[model samples]
Target: MKKSGMSLLEIVISISIAVVIFIPAMNMFSTTGQAVFKTRNFSFANSAARRISQRLMAMPYEDIVEVPLPGIALFDAPAESFFAPFLNTSGTNSGAKNITQADMPEFYSYLVQHDFRYSLSVSNVSFGDGDEIKSVGILITWSENNKNMMYRLYVYVPSL
Candidate 1:
């Protein structure tokens, strides 16, 4: 008698091969998805840093001085530890100076809407141009896949 259908052994072998191929394909897809997410997050953080840097560059050269204004605070308190030195806390107000969302409502709102936190600081830097140049640094932080990620940007502004 000729068998018109696959034997049980053949059927089992085919199923096993399919499962082996499927598992690795599924894993590859998962890894690709994770990589895509990380790239997107990095792009977003970089953009935010650039935006803050542009704002700093737009300010008058003298305004880059570290001033102690009361209402300017960091978006995240923890960031203060890493950015204290660059902070400009020596200008006018002396009442608990901090950089808060209120300082730039538009920036703050955009960050909040995207679940990001940022810190901006300015410091004196001599770029072979005496004391006429200032350095501005912006740090943009966000969480991705339970990991903390940060993007940093630095810009030099001249007294022009």
Candidate 2:
């Protein structure tokens, strides 16, 4: 009599082949997804850093105050004024002087909206004696899989 259906051996062979092919395909898909995510985050972080740098650059050379205002830390500014536009702070008044601990106002908010975490830093560079040009650095950092991602931006401000 002729067999009407696939034999058990044939069925098992087909299932095994399918699994072998499927696992690698699935792995590839997962890897690609992770890579895409990383690329997106990098792009976002870089954009944010550039935006902040542009704002700093726009400031008049003399208006770019590197010195900490009284009651503020080094290279720090009131969060409400600088970051509020980007990060959502509850209080109308930003008493926070530290730029790091302060909640992200503008850029941070954007990152949060996109499910990305980030941090920023600004520093002033001064040569010996009084120099009209000041160097500003903006550092942005984020995280994925408990690993930190970072980007740096530098700008030179001429005296206004």
Tell me, what's the RMSD of every candidate? 9.8, 7.5
TM-score of every candidate? 0.57, 0.61
Off by over 4 Å in 2: 60-83, 87-110, 113-130
Clashing residue pairs in candidate 2 are 86-105, 86-106, 87-104, 87-105, 87-106
Q: Largest TM-score belongs to which candidate? A: 2
What TM-score quantifies how close candidate 1 is to the native fold?
0.57
Tell me how candidate 1 scores on lDDT.
0.62
Model 2's alpha-carbon lDDT is: 0.57
> How do the residues 28-123 of candidate 1 rate in per-residue lDDT, one tens digit apiece?
999999898778778867875675566677766765544332212334444333322224556744433333454546655544544566765677
